[model samples]
Target: MLQLEQFEVRERKLQFIKEYDVEKIHQAKLIVDTDISSSVSLIELAHMVGLNDFKLKKGFKEIYGTTVYNYLYELRMQEAKKRLLNSSQPYYLMI
Candidate 1:
């Protein structure tokens, strides 16, 4: 029962995000920073987007040119890269 309600909230949030879609390259930061945990099911994004898993899966690939999961994965990697590349290392590691 609780899970079902949570699904509705997640769908609402996902719809808002999709409708407002812009150049995701620049906006990836915003997406990464946004608190989607409250609204969207991180477990299965297509369900949150209100599509059958396969259709949402294929549509994302066609429209966005990448799977949603892959896009999210890349965003996390980019963030990690930024942190790793920008931070100063320990003196021992640097040497």
Candidate 2:
């Protein structure tokens, strides 16, 4: 009976996480885009957005079709390319 009760509790928690996954994923994307240059870990991101690490990682990929790191990396690279093409500033200074 105790084991069954624990299982039920776990399931409830997971259900709650799933219910909020969409909102959490949106928040995660905003956090990443807001600071693409900064190094943020999954735990940090999940904490900031009120999600567990596993749910955040899985939901982000499900909603965005890419991992969080990859999404941020692509954004950074695109921004760098745009700056390099648009600005006459030296490459070293940009770095």
Candidate 3:
């Protein structure tokens, strides 16, 4: 019975960590999406979203299947391509 109680406590702790990691990853993604042009460092982002750098990096990659920098770069590139194809503005202005 004591062992079973200890196991239950361990499971609860693991569940809490998992939920917290998910929340942090979601916030990180939001920050990335909201300001892709901003040159924020990963450490800074981690601090902003209340996560340590290593956990933030690992959790972000786990949740999104890409590194934060790569995700932002992909988003920027896609947006640029969309604008180039659809906008009437000059090419230089788009850049």
**Across residues 14-80, which tens digit of lDDT does each residue of candidate 3 receive?**
4645787779879989998998889999999999999899988877766566799899999999988
Write down the RMSD of all candidates, one decimal each.
14.1, 10.5, 8.9
Report the error of model 2 at residue 5, Å: 40
Write model 1 residue lDDT over 53-83, tens digit each, in one string.
Answer: 5655544554455765676677667866776
lDDT of each: 0.52, 0.84, 0.84
What C-alpha lDDT, on a 0 to 100 scale, does residue 33 get in candidate 1?
A: 44
Clashes of 1: 1
List candidate 3 stretches off by more than 4 Å.
Answer: 1-17
Misplaced by over 4 Å in model 2 are 1-17
Deviation from native of the Cα of residue 33 in model 1, angstroms: 7.1
TM-score preference between candidates 1 and 2, better one:
2
TM-score of each model, paired residue for residue: 0.47, 0.75, 0.76
lDDT of 1: 0.52
Write model 2 residue lDDT over 1-95, tens digit each, in one string. 99788767666555555667779889989988888888989999999999889989887776666899899989999998999999999999987
